[model samples]
Target: MKNSAVRLTFLGGVNEVGGNKILLEDFNYNVKILLDFGINIKDYNDQYDRNEVPNSIKELVKLGLLPEAEKLAIINLYTDYHVKKNQDSNDLETNLDGIFVSHPHKDHFFGLSFVNRNIPIYTGVFTKKIISAYYKCSKTSIINNYGGLNWKLFRTGDILDIKGLEIIPVHVDHSIPAAYGFIIKTSGGIVVYTGDFRMHGPLAAMTQDFLNEIKNTLKILHQQENKRGEIQKPRETKVKLLICEGTHIHKGAIESENNVEQNLEQLFTKHPFDFLLVKFDRLDWDRFRTFSSIAQKFRWKFIITEKDAYFYYLLNKDEIHESMKNPNIIADDHILILTQGTVKYRWQEKIRQAIYKEEKGHRLIKYNEIKELDSGFFFYITSLRKDVIEKLNPNFRGAFISSSVDPYTEEFIDNNRTLSRFFRKIGIPSYRVHASGHAMPHHLINFIQSVNPEYLIPVHSDQPHFFKTFFKNSKIKVMIPNKNDRFELKSGIVNGSGVF
Candidate 1:
């Protein structure tokens, strides 16, 4: 039977940040698929009014934020509760075939509860564990009835066949641990979807593996088909469209690896403080490693919260214990500082009870283990959540370290200044000492040249036009898709002007 042409439509995450939704359809039949269901948090905040009537997805369509729905099949849920809470009620009512969660990041997978309970969710084991933790802490029973929802666990290289569509999950490097990119195969051709990624972390090797796979898949498909034939020949591997991210396209390549390490060392060496306080995104394992290395070299005790310690355990249990072997590394009073978040509250209580009962007393480090006279470094791995920082006010002191990228905006800077003022009021000198997780423009150009995809569509960025500069000399078709714009794939040519 002759196959139908495939169509891809972007609903969000096209020209701006947040609200990443896309629709895939087979023109010859009634099959439809959705890639991501995200919400624009910034937009929501701007239009929010508690006294007004709840907005619906249809209402969002009126605002040109969402696509007009025809038949919704598969919906990949990739957003958080904050966005979903403000979603028009009608949007939440759209039934879906399955929910493909990328990771546990609030911006990527926090909006799952807004959907119906019967839809199946495809995710990895690590993602499941994190989501479970999130649920436990939030006391949200949305995921408690797992019996009603099908939870499919898939690792890298696992191929899932749903209806007529084939999905292969490929692990990618990101700030979060359980990040994944996907390759969707249909009757038309293969579509590579890179959720979000970076190249300067432990997952670099994995990213290379995924790139190799894409290259191999495309090569095999080319070998089996003759492009010159009047009737397109069947190919072993065929990629009809490449849906990629352009998060940092507009920014110049900021040398991160060596520069960040050097910056950290220089700051620590120059500062003459008794206690060094470093702030970073807890999920960023690379930054964590950098901070730990600096702390160890300075002969300062590496202090982190028990909650962050758990994540460290998950990412690098061997390294954590190995560092603990050094007399300088301490867990109880000397090393691990407990945070007062809902997630940490339960774990802290449990550890406290065990310490009080002396059941596992040896596991707890004594105050004597810490050398109060010696200059020490303290690492505070946390988020921008106001509540988290408010609770951290008492113990955090001395030189402050920011090992994460701050949002770039005048308002964001003002807010950060307010935060810095607050920290200064508490006597801590704050500084930013972090690296980015997205590839810079030059790095992205190198990647595009290496992969050499026939077609490239950039998403997850505000400056999609920047791609034009990098591909100026190339013959490959470069397209900047807009929200609700449709692209048909069949004869190796893209159809449609794309939504503006």
Candidate 2:
């Protein structure tokens, strides 16, 4: 490879839905940044059970859970405490500047806990809070601790000059708040990476703002280049490459969050259930807010698991998106913190104190209290709490709403089946009311067309071929990269079209 070339290596998120680890190396500028170093959920589960996950980074790398240390070539990326235990290998060197995390999702930032504490991890301001809240609430696992490392926070519209690369993080609408897509200007060319996003989300306008910013960046790049060279006619697109996620590319326009709310309300009204049990992704604050609002609307108490309560309490402490902030989770009579198990972690005790100190009523609703509830309650539970629900002994008047994505993996499929059987045994009718976090196929196509990059590389999808098919008539060259595939981009063009 030429020293001036910009190289992109797909280490993980290829032909998969998550576990996105992309390495971008600009040797000309001496800039190396890994975008979204997250573990692929299925791959991680396949390698080891939750109870048997390795704590050491070396062990994880040996098991192919992380990028190979030799290939990364970044020294001090892992703490000496983790790598020094095994003396067979020499220490890795450094040119790696930082790992830019796009969001707080486990599939995007879970692996940070295993990284070296010295390397700076960049994340949005609210994204950092959510990740830290996750770490504080959960057991100190490799994924949860996030390595307790150096964290540099940035908000939308911030221009981060890491070495020579200029990374502009623009907020994008995903399932979670503080999700971002980046416009990175390298010596070779401009590379636009669309971190997981959707157009039909509640905050779809944020995604549009990101798209507008990309166009503005191209104009800025043109203005800067015109100063040194002959004035050339502007092309429709100037972005050298675009890396995007196609998690739901096979499906056409999915339902919007508003549609989800409408469907959920319909279900609630149709059933008129005395009490409700709801399940959603823990970090899905939008869905949590949706349910909580409905509970308040119905004059029912919104009950959340202690874990959810912890996140809600933390998020409420700061300024965030207006639609997401809710003082009710901690202060209102309409909210209840459901505590079934004894407090195990120190964080749980802190949560207990926060709730008791802030809320006036005896808001801690125990599992036994749930059984005695006659009506007017919305109990939120996580996947691990299905057994807890069984213990609650819900009445037949209760309904279960699975307000999360449908199972896509084998393990999740099996778990869903088990949950279904349990729901059946409990004699409560179950409903699936959810909106996907990813963009629909049509929206994704429109987004790529709008960006109009010289080359388009699709990741975080099982059906990558869909991108090729959709872009065949367009000018975009859809590059389907496999795991660990490397491509050299020099002077705004790929050196070779064929796989390396």
By lDDT, the best candidate is: 2
TM-score of each: 0.75, 0.92
lDDT of 1 at 385: 36
List model 2 lDDT by residue over 117-233, tens digit each: 666789998898888777666666554555346799998878999876789999999887889999998777788889899988889999999999999998877776676553576
State the lDDT at 195 in candidate 2.
Answer: 86
**lDDT, model 2, position 354:** 83
Task: Give the Å error, residue 282, model 1.
Answer: 2.4
lDDT of 1 at 225: 56
Clash count of each predicted structure: 9, 4
Residue 55 C-alpha lDDT in model 1: 45
* Segments in model 1 whose C-alpha atoms lie over 4 Å from true places: 1-3, 27-31, 44-95, 139-149, 223-238, 257-259, 302-334, 339-348, 351-375, 379-397, 405-418, 424-427, 497-500
Q: In model 1, what are the clashing residue pairs, if there are any?
A: 55-88, 56-88, 78-108, 79-108, 79-110, 79-111, 80-110, 221-237, 279-401
